[model samples]
Target chain A: MKKGIILVLVIVGLLVTTSFASVEKPVMGISLISYYNPFFLALRDGAKEALDEIGGTLLESDSQQDVAKQLAAIESFISRGVDVILLNAVDSEGVIPAVELANEAGIPVVTVDNDASGGDVEALVASDNVLAGKLCGEYLVEKLKNEDGVPAGNVVVLDALPVTGVLNRLQGFYSVIQEYPQIRIVSTQNAQGNRTDGFEVMENILLANSNIDAVFAINDPSALGALEAIDAAGRQDEMFIVSVDGAKEAMEAIKNGTSFEMTAAQLPTLIGKIGVETAMKVLNGEEVDRFIPVDVFSVTPENVDEFLEMATF
Target chain B: MNPFVSFLYKNKVTVAFVIIFIFFAIFIPNFLSLNNLMSVGKQIAVNGIIATGMTFVIITGGIDLSVGSLLAVAGVFCAMLVKSGVNSIVVILLTIGLGILIGLTNGLVITKLKIAPFITTLAMLSILRAFALGMSGGRSVSGLGDTFRFIGRGEIFSIPFPLFIMIVVFIIFGFILAQTKFGTHVYAIGENEDTSNILGLKVDKNKIIVYCISGGLAALASIIQTARLNSGQPLTGEGAELDAIAAVVIGGTDLNGGYGRIIGTVFGVAIMGMLTNGLILLNISFYYQLAVKGLVILFAVGVSRKK
Candidate 1:
């Protein structure tokens, strides 16, 4: 039995060496903030697929949503001398010094989904968050028109302050909503972009306002949370919710005809695919755009079913 | 000192609760409504359950910083088990057992190594959280069915199931602490460990049991929290231990131990819950809410001090 096991191990080792001997595989190191977000998981899967097709080995590390941990992962990537570094920074500014170190080590850095501030990052691949928010606002205005040929509603905004992406999305939504004079934003509260916070914040909002017509959540989790509160308050038929991030839960909510009406899909998998391709471009000394914007689209009850199959939880 | 001032110090938490409740009821619209009051009750139920156990540990003069992390672990495991078609009762027992085992490990180490509870539990906090993240692969364990949700979302006689659980925990633990021999030893150990040891009290055994209770309560709280959220998050109870500690302290429980009541913690949890709900109703920004909470904690600690 020992001899048989030894022979199998030798065969497996020979197969691995022979496969790698034909083509030199470029190594790509990925430092993600955390894998908790389904969006990030989709992103990782896309990057892995792209890298695999190119005969490149991917080294992945999770930073557990800590800036210091993310920096350490980047530092280790630099020490390992990988061909490229892909960073999904926990804190954009906090990641700059790590990006600088990578630059000093003569390794190219490609930031995906979030940018690193004050660094010569070779490229940044992120969804156009402002555009995403604008799409949702546009959809809401068109769908929420009254019989008097005007759009009007008292809206609650679920803000996740201190997150640049969320802020930008809100700003974009505000710009479009203000154009409709009859609509008014009744209250704004921070839900921190999580379902639990979203539910609590929404519950408080429900208590404060009795005539809320719509809700704009910074992300899908908050939107889903608001839906829960709406259901509990027995106001689901009256309240409408639009949010960013076409996450699986939101898509399910849409399919079920819940208060969640629309979601602006960030298409994280596409962003990841672009992220790896851009990293390879920089590694090959090919010209790549400093900022690459992945297009985002609005998902509604009308079109959400098409995305349900592809969405990751 | 005035007699009134002395009376106020003696009944600080209760007085504070009455004042805060009355203030919010008068100033905030719909604050006294049944639905809103129930909402606040449901929100604090998780904290209250964990704080009940925390009250025991704190009275015994030990801190369990690992409760929050243990909550996440229990919650994630429960969600995973439910997802894999495990029986709900068995899952509950297994998850809770895991928590007690971890707590036993904490107790054993602290007793054998003579380590400070603060330092030991702080280390356990990081270790437990890391284990949770590893087990869940940094993703939320979700898709739990309606039967599981009933624990968090269901209601009987218009009271949330979680609040009912919290009340039951408070009564059971409260009774044990106020009327049992184990409770007396816990107080003695917290007041003076060396003296308790000299008195031939099973100080180490009591401490271990206290920690195990804390761990078990945390697991129970996590089950309800997971049910309430409809998901098991790796980061579910992030910084929650602090909230439990704050609840105990604001209830006028001494950080130095041997000087508090579980009933005091009930009022403390209520105040914290109302404060949060009131701030939001007042249109306060989220940033300022943290500041207000900190100020309230300081004030509670101050008012509880003897002049």
Candidate 2:
């Protein structure tokens, strides 16, 4: 009983002092998707770097792919009166309640990588996923078409449903591919952008369709997984794979002569950096763009070396 | 007594499965194709194996909520060992052994410390998943070789290799449950623990061994899963325990534990897989499919209750 009392006392003291300490620095609370993904890790690092340069303090929380926890974090940030809020939503639509809570609290929100469908936000920084998908489509059209410029092949699409960003990529890819009537979509299944699901779903697809020429995955994990399935089926040579998300594994696969051919790389670090910069601007009573487009580029085997070098540092 | 009522009472689960299967096969395009059939078999193989073990536990009136976490643990162990160039045979044995050891711990805690089985296994679920995350540094372990993949993707006579494994596991366990004295004691203990103890049944020993079997089956399923993905994902099998339990209960196994059949669980797993496949083929949204699955489970269980 005595120990419990002392522990409570210490926590109370810390909370009181922390509240007072917040006045000196412009505090920004970041609710990230999760730090397990290397993409998100780089984003956090870039955000911290930008915040450090501006002499601002960053209070961060890992959502761990839970919207309830993100909402609680937002509520706590609001109660703590943080100057700005940065969010990487697990679900763009599921985050509206929390975003609205922050909006009601008069705390400016800078959504990074993912968007909030409802409630007002100071800025939204994300990759042009539609353009990224188009890039992949154009690359596939160039690489797989016959010398006569005719495109024709059986394609499988591994999708991650419920995420708006992934859906946009798929929409964009489909828009570009629909122009070629000969390029048939043999199957489209939800893999949840997970390596294991990707492998399993791709295997099932291969079972249903024996003549798959290419796979368009929503992310690199799915692409790598499909590559595994194709390799297991002894059809790696016949099947090519493309995806978004310039993950390290996809880069290594391309360099090592696997079936994964190309991926559209999103600048997560740049997105994070810009997220903090825009948050700081909001803190200073300066207006920022409602939508900020982070740059994305297609990475193929030819230029994977450059991206790999950048990744190392 | 009505003949139809008597038939439904005797074989409600199988009858329900047949009706659902026929409906999908007729209404859904390509649902009866050899390709689609094989895919369904492969998809349910992992859950089928785990649910078979779960049938044993439920028969003894116990639950093993840690099976899903155990899957991730075993999977991560396999991938790490393979990545380090360890022999595949050695890695497989060690992974299964780890699972047994963990299962033994859960059994002992519940039996020796007198904790409830639910609490013991629930705590195990949290600890095992956290251990997996820590062991893999919160990242997926990948880059396994081709030999590992064959266990998951290989086929014998046009049947998926995992499906064959699931069938073998069920046959062996089914025999043990129906024809062995130990199996009789397991049911007796579930029916009434005090009476079984008075009758000199080795209740504690049987419970421990049953849990060990559950762990071993989960580990086996994880090995196939890891091989199928060509990587050991720390987050794999996140909610597999619920699926296994659902299959067991839907197969006419009472949750209160005394009576259940492994063969019935097989039909249960098949029904669940067919539901997912049928919904996808019919172009239903994923969210609505979840509600449909829930409703089907309720209806199937309600029908079985008529027995």
- In candidate 2 chain A, what residue range of length 10 has the lowest lDDT sum? A15-24
- Clashes by residue pair, model 2: none
Native A-B contact fraction in model 1: 0.00
Runs off by more than 4 Å, candidate 1: A1-313, B1-3
lDDT of predicted model 1: 0.82
List DockQ for all candidates. 0.01, 0.02
Residue A191's lDDT within candidate 2 is 91
lDDT tens readout by residue for model 2, B46-163: 7998999899999989999999899888888988999999998998898889888888998899889989989999999999999899998766676675768678668988788988
lDDT of 1 by residue, B195-236 (tens): 999999999999999899999889998888777655576766
Model 1 chain A: ten consecutive residues of lowest lDDT = A15-24
Q: Give the lDDT of residue A286 in candidate 1.
A: 90
Assess every candidate by TM-score: 0.53, 0.54
TM-score, second chain, candidate 2: 0.98
